[model samples]
Target: MISLKPRWRSTLEKHRAKSARTERSGSVRLRIVAWTFLLTSFIITGLIFTVREILISDVGRGANSSTESEIGEFRNFAQIGVNPQTARPFETLEDMLGSYVTRQYTGYKEQVIGLTPHQIIFLEEQDHYALTTGYRLHQDQALLTGLRENPSNSGIEQTPAGPVHWGKVAVELRTDQGTTTGHLLVLEYIQPELDAVQHTVFIMIWVGVAGLAFTLLVSWLIATQITKPIRNLRQVAEHINDKNFSGRVTVKGDDDVAAMSHTFNKMLDRLEEATLTERQFMDEVSHELRTPITIVRGHLELMERTEEQEQTLLLVDDELERMGRIVSDLLTLAKSERPDFVQPHPTEVSELMISLDSKVQVFANHRWIIADIAEGEVGLDEQRITQAMLQLAANAAQYSPSGSAITIGSEFYGQGGERQLKLWVQDRGPGVSPEDASILFERFRRNNAKNPATAKQHSMGAGLGLAIVRSIAEAHGGGVWIAAPEDGPGSIFGISLPAPSPPKKTQSITATYPPQNEPEKS
Candidate 1:
């Protein structure tokens, strides 16, 4: 057994691991290119095969066509017609065939020959391209014997000049020398046809190889471009750590890969923002709770005598009350997350605003006024809406000057199907600051306490009021928002709630209402 030093072994292990990762990543591009080339190879091979088969079929058809053409030309000469081969009319059957064999239409593959009862005569042959053996079918005794013994109308014979297909036409003419009789033969050499097919197949093979090389190059380029995004994603993942996660994939197109990258970016943004919010929340909780504890400790530590018990108790009691309000607000927010938190029933919107106006009269000395009211029935938890509105009014009252007007209003705005309700409270105070607007509804987060105008206000409670307002609004499938008051020097805080679907516009029966004498249920 051999052992290496620790550092050397670790280095080798790391190197091997990196090599495996690289191989895995490279496989994606390799497989894509490989499959592409494989399919293209199949297509190219199929085209080459089909073309070669078609050319080979044409070889046989060409032979048949040449035989028929020669026969047709000779039949015309048997009649009183001019022989183009000799540029003269036939004097006899022998002259006609002899002149016919010399026609320009007769090529190397196609030949004309004549035969009689005694021996071969009027043999016309042309030089063949493939068979250098010259025309042997005209003189070969074996072919002649085969023709005499087995006189086929047309047949193939292997002669000295490769394979030859012979077509024979017996001729008879009424000349002065009685009825003359002889056989006219059309010989088509098959060697040239075979050579042509072979030549074509060779050319196709070279073209197919070129096409395959081109396909390979194109497939590699496409695969490399396609895998570029995946490589970027892998790089981002490798560097994604808790402390450093700013890496992002560059989106290039509106394709699926771009959508995936966009969704991933959104998820990262949410996670980072959530982490920062959680840390800020923890810090605020500590500070808010620590303040009361410090105050109580200070009071008890400096008292130092029984005579100061009443005063110290009073001071501690105030701090304890402040802590109690914070606990109550937190509990209310937690309960608002439950499904039954806001049980809505149909209530007259205008009547509910009136009820709120009466209830908020004693919350502070500010002159509370109903700015406006919308007339309709809305689905809402009457007590909850009142409480949410009262919370907004209370916040306004705490910040506004004595006897200043704190406006309360409600309105309806929507179309198609269902309408929504916007209930708001306007306060005449030092309008909202830019820095405090973003975190106004966060728990344990009050408005800019550093502002002297805000600190001077006697507002002493946890900043969970607006958070509770937001929870109530969301429970009704709505949201809360803040805006600047129109024609005013203050800010407007509002909650928008989705009203339940309205009653039908037209009715077949008369409209009716419950008698006023009947008391409503609690």
Candidate 2:
């Protein structure tokens, strides 16, 4: 046998365990349904038996009444010495018993017997003479003794067929000079009554079976529907456990199961997002670090203690500074993905524009002007927004000619009951193409159509400034984009922030700038 590796063996065991759990879940549901149906069936059967006993007791009571009426008729005959039907006297004991039995007995299962202390004197029945012929009154001595000992007695006898309900009456027969005592026994074979009840019981049994079968079918269907979604959710969880988050359970009705499935799907969405972010972070780090490290390595290898050694050292320091900036920008971008990236507070828009005007003046000898300032406070991370606005200004300075007019401004625009603060830097520079505009804010991306004279004059730093700007704007729940002026041959780069709720009192400030005095050409 070939032995499996540890990881493979563990995976196989987990699969087996999961399959077993799944199977057990279905089996557990089936068992619950089956047991419930069986319990209900047994309860109904017991009720049927209870009702059967009540009906059988009623039949026994009716038989006793009939037996009592027969005994009363015989007692009247013996006391009056006359038959009420014929209005005549002089009847023997056997004759009286025969007459009374023939008159009182109405059903095939009923019998009447007359007995003395010594022998069975008379018996009458509808049919089945063997029952009377084989039943020896002397053989039931204990029963006879009980009847003689008691004036009237009633009891049940279990027979081969079923049961017999008997009522006995002891009486004394008297004529002018003689007296004789005998017993009158009335017997009812309860088999036919029991047979009727048994027939009803058989019908009830069939009904219970049908009901139980239906119950099982309905319970199985209900159980399957309830557990189906749970099974699907488990499968999806297993897929997610295997690092695949694309699987989702199908939600059915508005129930607990549906809610659970919805929550599971949402968890998968977050997991996918986090996994993608981690992979992107690693890729960006590796790609951004490689070039600077290679440049540092190349410069150090070629270093010589000559006249150019200082310049080479300066070049290495510049590359190291560039690497540091790249690392800082990457760190900022990574942190921006977190929840606490921006600490927002209310900052007046006019003050913000004035700050931007002062900050961007030192970047280049451009005719920097504050075109407009919207007078309102906006919730913003002041330092981060200033950093983003300054990056846009520096980008404008790079692309435009020296002494060119680069306008920095802020404004409020309202639409659909929502207000936003727009901070922009407009420059008369090489306008970006639509295709380039889409990707200009991504990391390590730059426009190829740079001013050749300026490109040769200044070292183009790492292309992470715009990306950092975008990250800051996104962290503030805002965004940055580039737009072309309708009439000007340049682009406007701006960031829009959601304006804060207005304060109780409002203030406005306005400033206008004159055209810059141009230096006279020599």
Candidate 3:
């Protein structure tokens, strides 16, 4: 059982009692934009940091390579390099060092210092000061003393020129006459490269900020476009009510959003139809029963003798029975909308039809025949399908001429996935017109005369029989329709069901008519 809880009446009243308010927009589009901007900003920051680290590392490595290269070049030069001016071995180590410094090139904020046990000397800016930070390193006694004391010569150190990578080599000036020992120092300034990396990172931060702003704006626009339709739907739904189901969502394209709008529109259509149906149902019922009810009441009140009273009572009983049948059919139609309306099982179609042919004969006096039997087992609600077929048979009996052949059978029609098992009743009667046939299964439609009525008198039914048949068929995932008469002046009422898969049992097929008074159950 479903729990029944009505919506808050106070909430509804409050909505109806108030006017719409204009407030700041609390839309999801902005939130998405904000998140996108934040996430992208973080990623940009990470990249900036990563790039800075990599560049700084590369700068450091370049400094080391410059220092090592300078030292290596000096070592080789001291051993073989001669003064280009003289084209001879230098008389002293200082001359060799000075000559080498004049010819060698140095990088940015880099310098070469030649030191001896007797004197400390270096290159000045006029010659190469731009590479030396213009610092008179030879005059910095403390740094010189520290370098002399420090045995390590291949690492960065805090010299007077700031942190610099420096390598020192002790070389023997191999002359044609003798050898002179001297110390050569290569100093590479790392500050300029570090500053360059910092500058690049600073520029990246500003670019990232600008790009983040652009991304935020673009994302906001896209999200707004995506949510516009949803907002429209919500606005329409807010004012929609049971009495007014006229709100239809606007569909713009063949996309998921359009599909959603179309589906919602369809739901509203069904709701409106159901509401109108319920509203008119009682009025129609009252109209149908009014005359019979008034006649029964009049007869009961005016009866004067025992014989007259008996006749009035019989007429009253017949009216009551008719009312009962109408009520029963209405109830059946209502129940058919429920999920449990049909209990389906595997059934042998041929045998079921043979059995139905027998029961059909008992509905009315007619030449009943088994036209065909679909030879297969199928999944269906046997009782409900039988009820629908019997209703069709009854319609035939009441509409066609007495003793006119009424054929009933099941056969397969259609192809592939659209295949169906069709159960039909064909009778020779004043067949329904094409336009009238369209609505024959709707409520309160009387059939073409059943079993040929007397020329002057034709009894009209409650008109719910075909409707009940339709309900039964629909409950089993099937449908009922009238086929255009192939033969003259007759109607073919068909109940179409979806074809079922292979059955568990393979039974032999047989087609035969049942006895008029009795339908043998399979």
Candidate 2 stretches with Cα past 4 Å from truth are 1-28, 48-59, 72-81, 85-95, 116-128, 131-152, 159-161, 241-243, 295-522
TM-scores of all candidate predictions against the true structure: 0.45, 0.49, 0.49
Predicted structure with the largest lDDT when compared to the true one: 3
Each candidate: how many clashes? Answer: 0, 0, 12
Flag regions of model 1 displaced more than 4 Å.
1-26, 81-96, 103-105, 122-131, 144-152, 155-163, 173-181, 241-244, 273-522
Q: What is the lDDT of residue 335 in candidate 1?
A: 63
Error of 3 at 521 (Å): 99
Q: What are the clashing pairs of model 1?
A: none
Per-candidate RMSD vs. true structure? 20.1, 21.3, 19.5
lDDT of 2 by residue, 1-522 (tens): 111111111122345677788767656467768887878888888988897888788878877777677667667766776665778764456555555655664456666676765555444343344465454332466755665566438777775545777778776656665766777787777777878977987897888888888888888888887788887887777656422467878888888879988888898889888877785775588567867777776767686757768787777766676676667767776666666778998888899888888888897678998888888767899999998998888888888887789888887777533777778888888888756776778778876667654784236467888888888886786677676766566778887777745546778866544424655555
lDDT comparison, 2 vs 3, better candidate: 3
lDDT of each: 0.72, 0.72, 0.73
How would you encode candidate 3's per-residue C-alpha lDDT over 315-412 as one tens digit per residue? 66666767756766766765665568899888889989988978986866689988777888678899988888888887777778877888887787
Candidate 2 lowest-lDDT run of ten: 1-10
Pairwise lDDT winner, candidates 1 and 3: 3
